[model samples]
Target: MADFDKPSSTEEEYFAREDIEKKRKLALQQADQLAAKQREDLRQLHFMKCPKCGMDLHTLKKGHVELDTCFNCKGVWLDAGELEQVLAQGSENNGKVMGAILNLFKRS
Candidate 1:
């Protein structure tokens, strides 16, 4: 008579290994997509050239919102609504905000 309850350990292991590899590939694909998206975001940011000198803008984070600064022309760039956000965050952390602003001024 055939054995009724033999464990198919080898078959189970093969399937499990295949599943792990599949998951690994999927994870790698997702990471590549995220990297591509981040690069695109940075590309768009770079396209926002300095109005004064037409150079790439560097980011400066103070309080809450991020501001762009032109290293070439020493100009600060602000987007819509970011000024209000910065002001609101500044009041909440006045000292820290002041320090950040001072640092930006020093850099300029």
Candidate 2:
């Protein structure tokens, strides 16, 4: 007769596979955490910094929009949808200027 208290070979194999699977899951979770940390670190390093000159950007108010200006390079940057807002508030001369600029990018 076999001893009932002893685990069979199949039971031991099952537990070993379960332990391996648990370790794999933990590794995946740690990788995700590490990736999120890296993205946040990069954002902190580049936030509100100029791309052209690597200088600090200043906010200048124009109508309802806030423009990002780099004093070191004399470069002006517009955020998302700011160009449309500027065109909306601008005069006929400004419209012509924007029209000419837009036309430069149009395909024949």
In model 1, which runs have C-alpha deviations exceeding 4 angstroms? Answer: 1-46
What is candidate 1's lDDT per residue for 1-108, written digit by digit as tens?
355576488978999999999999999999999999999998887687997888988998765688898878788888999878877777788657756775766752
Q: Every model's Cα RMSD, please?
A: 9.5, 7.3
lDDT of 2 at 5: 84
Q: What lDDT score belongs to each candidate, Candidate 1 first? A: 0.82, 0.79
What residue pairs are clashing in model 1? none
Residue 57 Cα positional deviation in candidate 1, in Å, after optimal superposition: 0.7
Q: Write the per-residue lDDT of candidate 2 for residues 1-108, one digit (tens) a residue.
A: 477888999999999999999999999999999999999999999888899998988887766767787777766688999988778766646666556544534555
Q: What is the lDDT for 61 in model 2?
A: 72
Best by lDDT: 1
Taking all chains together, each candidate's TM-score versus the true structure is 0.49, 0.76
lDDT of 1 at 82: 87
In model 2, which runs have C-alpha deviations exceeding 4 angstroms?
A: 91-108
